[model samples]
Target: MAQLIKLEDYVSRYEWNAYRYPSQFIRMKQDNWKKLYHLWRNEAFVGDQQQANMEPAASKWKSLFKFGFRKTAEETAKNSDVTDLPATENELRHYFLDKLYPVQLKWASSTVTEVSFVDQTYYANDRLKYFLKRFPDTFLVMYHPVFNVKKAPVDGEIILISPIGIEILYLIEKQPGTLITADGERTWLVKEEAKSETKILSPLLALKRTEKILKSILKQADIALPISKVVLSPTNHIASLKAPYNTKLVGKHAYEDWFAEKRNLVSPLKNHQLKTAEHLLKNCRTTAIKRPEWESDDNSVFPNDTV
Candidate 1:
């Protein structure tokens, strides 16, 4: 019979830990600010001053600094706007940090480094996961599988490995506007107001690039699998999204029906479906760095040294 494997069982430790970056980054920022404040205080108050005056000033500064820091962190955390909080440690990590890790350094290097996203893509993915969990025999759903393409990392939000083919889902959250896109265009038009329209990056093109990278990775494994792209909008409606014919543009309400119909069309070869699932699980698992064996001559290397 076809067997389903949860993401935790199919992925490596590295991939599982990748999602912790968001929380870690937040903590690091807070810590760094405190360190900076202490350093500044040490340098600024070098001269001899009354202990009473110094104590009051330090207390005031500390309280103000803490209030500001807490407010800022809370805002950052709330910015995710994900309605469904993750239940497991792995899910929570991925829910908060997966999207940020790949581009965190890039944004950090930029002149304007405030990274914010309106789309609740993670929320959409979680909803899909909730639905897929019901069928443990026919589908293997992977969430946010990151791959290295030409030395650059690319993230595939959702990958459904089935008997028919591999369906890659790109989640787009609801926007406060009417969205319109034209095939072959890199930018999409969003009309938020009656008189003004803004251009945003095309999710279709992003899905295509993700597909290309995924294909390259599978090719390296000598595994040729049929692949298709899907744009899933769980909370938004596209007024006019002119996507390519090959791409499946689906909305939240229609997804369950569409998935059921697709599942029904699959051939009833249970054993074949199981084999295909196993093959993908084996090849698509992220590569984790192995610890080096302890030896006398291995002083130059550490226990976590990986090839």
Candidate 2:
């Protein structure tokens, strides 16, 4: 077995904007087995007796309700067994590659042609071809257009970690809104919204939630990292952030520029830390890009601009 780091070393506090970071993490059956076992052994089985009469707060009936809840939870957990870290990691690879493949083709099409319509068509058909060239092994970026991963060497709890910088990146896609940030703080430059979570979901909240998920996964995998997150936006929305913090924000217009800047900021982690991340990413499959739902109608948002 590869000498993995101690689980404790990977468990660090993750905080957003706040001074104190929260110790949120994923728990695994093995890690909590002892505690869970003790809880189960000491706890009563179904129909255990309790204080049936008294004030509502101190009532035996309440105790019975609590027991039911605990039993239900344990039953659900047993039935919905968590995926081993390695399997989850591999599945994530398939998930991402399925999602990202389209973007790669689009980026590639942006080059090597002038006629937008023709270029789009050709690249759309050849996405798999490019995918084959860009990725040789099991590094999934887009999706499952290509297969044979089962034939690849695979094992362990693989986590798809969102870097700590995820909050800074906004999932931009909206009609209009103003974004502001301090000089050095990181934030997404957005003008759009992904239809998933709305209610004006804060990118900060999104990133924090993503961090929590990774932590939970780490706890389950019994592995860890200094993962981060960043918000991403489209270029069309650059005009929307009238007043924004100096944090990192990128969209269509600034993608190239953002990479140029961020490239210098990826400091080297400890040698082992880097390897762990590399292992996770290498096992993943990038996603395939699906045409936006509106693309099917051909109800043309930009009639003048073809494809």
Candidate 2: C-alpha RMSD to true structure equals: 25.8
What would the TM-scores of all predictions be? 0.46, 0.27
lDDT of 2 by residue, 1-307 (tens): 0111111111111101011110111122122333333323333222343533123222322222222111234544653443222124345334333323333333322222110222233333433443233332212122211111345422222122222222223344445443322122234332224433223434554455435544553455556555545445543434333433333445556766654443343332233333334333333323223334433321111121110
Model 1 poorest ten-residue lDDT run: 298-307
For each of the candidates, the C-alpha root-mean-square deviation to the true structure, in angstroms, is 15.8, 25.8
Query: Which residue runs of candidate 2 sit more than 4 Å off their true CA positions?
Result: 1-170, 175-199, 219-224, 236-248, 251-254, 261-307
lDDT of 1: 0.47
Clashes of 1: 0
